[model samples]
Target: MRNMILAVIGLLLLGCSGGQSSNSTMTVSGVAATGAAVSGTIFLKDSAGHELSMATTDGTFSFDVSALKPPFMLKASWGGKTMYSFAAAAGTANITPLTQMIVAAAASSTDLDAAYQAPSPTTFSTIAANLPAATANLRNSLKPLLASYGADMDPISGKFSANGSGMDGLLDHVAVTSVSGTVSITDRSSGATLFSATASPALANSVSAMNWANDSAAVAQDPDLKVSEAGDGLAVWWSYTGTGYGASVIQARWLNSEQSATQISTATGFAMMPKVAIDGNGNAVVVWMQSDNQLNNVWVNRYVAGSGWGSPKKLTSAVSSATGPSGVPSIAIDAAGNAVIMWNQSDAAVSSHFDVYTSQYSVANNAWSTPAMLSTGTNSAYGYKVVANNSGTAAVIYNQFQRTDGRGGNGDASDIWVATGTTAGGFATRTKVSSSANPIYGQGSLAIDPAGDILAAWIQNNNSGYFDVWASRQPAGGSWEAPKTVANSVTGECYSPEVALDAHGNAFATWEQQLDTEGRQYVAASHYSAASGVWDAPAEISENIGNTYDQHIAVDPSGNATLVWYQIESAAVTVRSAQYLQSSGWGISQLIATMGAAYDGYTVFPVPRVAVNSSGKSIIIWGTGSM
Candidate 1:
């Protein structure tokens, strides 16, 4: 069976403004049928049909139209479809009501508004006619197998079942061994167990069995445990280590609830901090950092929709002495599949100081662009984070220590700096985003909204009693907003702050706070409202599962947030996740995976990273120590 990955792209606009005003101004707000905050292109045209002002990714496009004539039109579009056109007069506050626009499937070419107004029968018939031929082709191809397995086939429902003989025939085609009274299958890379009932020859299985079975008996199959439409047809990139040595390997898999996973590639000598970005054509590009001997290098690989996996290409060949067994790397891929990867590098020239470096991966030519230096000031630049939007615009944020009086002992002062440019090329100038005379020093995380705006959060301790979480944002086409305190650590220290921004400009942030009384780390979070331009009160995302560190947060396009962290207790660490419920608050934190008796002296934990698609589906990937 051939496996294919699907990618969908939708345009979005983000609005950023300065301080609030008391003067009366027009406020436009609406929601789509999918509950996505309605945001897109808004154009103001004059009486003569001349475009006066236009809004792109940034929400508000203002002009000196207050002196212009009256009787203008406010035209808007959302989700790549026109929503409504309103007539308005100058200086009048106008708010367009929420408009419902019909959405068509992938194959439909007719205009959405026209199709909605047409007869119901015509629309249905048109949809049926445009349905892909793959559905029918697949059903017909599996019919013969159904008969041979004595399975009953239902064409309408696309279900197949076998009672006795059918099940026997299906099992005969695949290799299944009994292990400790359980049926198990072993493959070259992994192993899986089949249900006792399914292993029996009396029940006929469906076509899913054949599609998911490994091509060779040496390859293990993945168990299809959960079946949900929410995460169906989703592709996630992750890394896992098998019994191998010499080089680290990271792999990408395209998964669908109804089909087998498609493996992209297994690149070696790379750390498992894998990052992936998909294009509209279902093509994906993955990037990771590989440490060879004592030298660290970054690499990129591509997976086309039809092709399985392409060869891996080296993005950077810089040799350095910073050969540590464990170093975290960060990467981001744009809509064009151009990847911007950043990592800390220690060289002989800058002893004891690690600098952040970045390189770009170009998908058009299947090669990495020239490596560019993102950080310039001093040698104490670290904890680099990067984000890129669909337009190939990228922003990289990091902490830089100003070389003070040629004396360096813990670097009394630090500052956060940001560099932005089109991924096309030429990143020569970097702007300092954080204005801290006596800045705090720690690792930070960054997120880019659809409009290419940026949000950065980190932990800083400027001789204060305890470290606190600080956040700043660069609104669309505007400089970074003043840094504000997101959470205060009165007793203990707050560290490892991470932030993620949704399509609606809503920012979700998470961090680890150490309580002085118990010396336990608790996970906390806060939400920033775009409508009110203020952060909601800080809320605890994790509970009971105390004594944790290295927390990461992810926000979906619909403003849903998920936070994952590692909890250490009794000298062992466990992974846990807490999901946010906008309707009823946060759900109870649940433990995801645990390290058992095989715990080594080193920490056995998962360093979580997450991404969300336009459909609000999310994928999280993390690494764990050997058990």
Candidate 2:
């Protein structure tokens, strides 16, 4: 009887132990997102580099952690980037870019892979202890965004869905990137920075919002944004589809002390490609191509210092109801508010041929002069770019097709030509600047210095059938230098060169270079030092991931420059930029805008434009199809 009773007690103890084991099976669950649902595998890992649980998720995930340990790391991989989250107790942990930022801040390091591969009990404890503070710091940094999106719940441990609401909405409008132990938060729509500093506990307390320029809205493509040399004024213009007119119209915004977007073009057909320039005295000149049902004409508008945008003025005439049009307008303004405008207009007498034309804006009279024919070429000429110096000297460059040059028309082979003039439209004799054997020199960009020196950059096909970047320098009151190749890749083509010159005559040029026959292009830049009188070897300014194009560069009086471009990689399109300092060389490229996944196929890759002031203050603007 005693042996039987002892056996019964042992059985009762075993039953109780099994019941406790069944009750202690804990499961961790949450959502994984990066604007769009992370439709990938989510892994739950421990501090010991052990994968505790793995599950495929459409964003929401659950991990059975009954047999796992504490201090877990949740990772979601997508878009070739890994996002992470930390869970001390494993209740709910959402894997996201922001959560990874918080984890990085708590650990005082951005090398998350290193930490994840080699974490100790002490390291895990330290991260757990600092998680709250890090969370608060990230929240503070994103206060405005959180408030705007109404995301009051905790990002890591919150019960949120990846359905474009709450935390998902916040994620849609911001881009969080970690580099060199620092975290940067930028507005996704505008690329306006919100916070950039070391991922530490003091981040939110020491940093204020850098997104004051956010308008919470977007414009159409081909927007031009410029800043004054004094850094006190800003002007932006773009062409957008009008509601009542059922056609595209040009609109502008001037910010000195107050501003709002005002439509400058009253076109019934379409007004497009609005380019703007702001002078030192807070004055601005905007020019665009407006259609009058039969022919497209160039129009101009001026914004006075104290007043708003003046009425739109037509600079070119729609001579006849013929199909010939005047378009591709470019503008520049001098320090004294003098302006120069350039465009290509069809020669009424010559069919199917276009000629370059120029018009000047007088600050004294606040009126644009009559369009003057600058290119006397009987051959077709187009792709005009213009720039103005502080002394009111303007420079223009274009490409003119030759009738037959034995070499090869290759479907309209052209030569690059340049000319200089005054703000009063009196241009000097046109000079052919490019002497390349390949007659197809195009994509010309022009820049002028305070002393009236001009730099022209273009691309011409080499004998190998690959396009290469070529640039020439015309010294103040001197002849044009022989065009030199600045960038030549062995297997790919380079095109769309943009050049900018500072007051000291230093020139910076950037262009898009093809990576493969698959149509992948990367941004490459070369610096031309006036002191050295040589173009530096070209450097790749962007990653070789996408097709980059529409690159535009601007320089201030102090030799500081800002270059902007847009890249399309897969279904994602991004606006990116790089800064050039005379003292430090070119800085690393940065993200200016990241179009959200909601409009993946419908995304509009706007031609990103940037302007910088002498103080290095810059404002970049681009258009979008949707928010």
Best by lDDT: 2
Model 2 lDDT per residue over 546-615, tens place: 7777777777677767677777767577777776655456767776666655434234444566666654
Worst 10 residues of 2 by lDDT: 1-10
Give each model's clash number: 14, 1
The lDDT values for all models are: 0.51, 0.71
Q: RMSD of each candidate? A: 20.6, 13.4
Q: After superposition, how far is residue 239 of candidate 2 from its true place, in Å?
A: 4.7
Which lDDT tens digits does candidate 1 get at residues 54-168? 4444222333444444333344566675543222232221212111100122113214344333324444344334333322432332433344456433222122122224422
Off by over 4 Å in 2: 1-218, 230-235, 238-246, 255-259, 318-323, 404-410, 517-519, 598-603, 625-627
- Give the CA lDDT, 0 to 100, for residue 101 in model 2: 85
Predicted model with the maximum TM-score: 2
**Residue-level error in angstroms, candidate 2, position 350:** 3.2
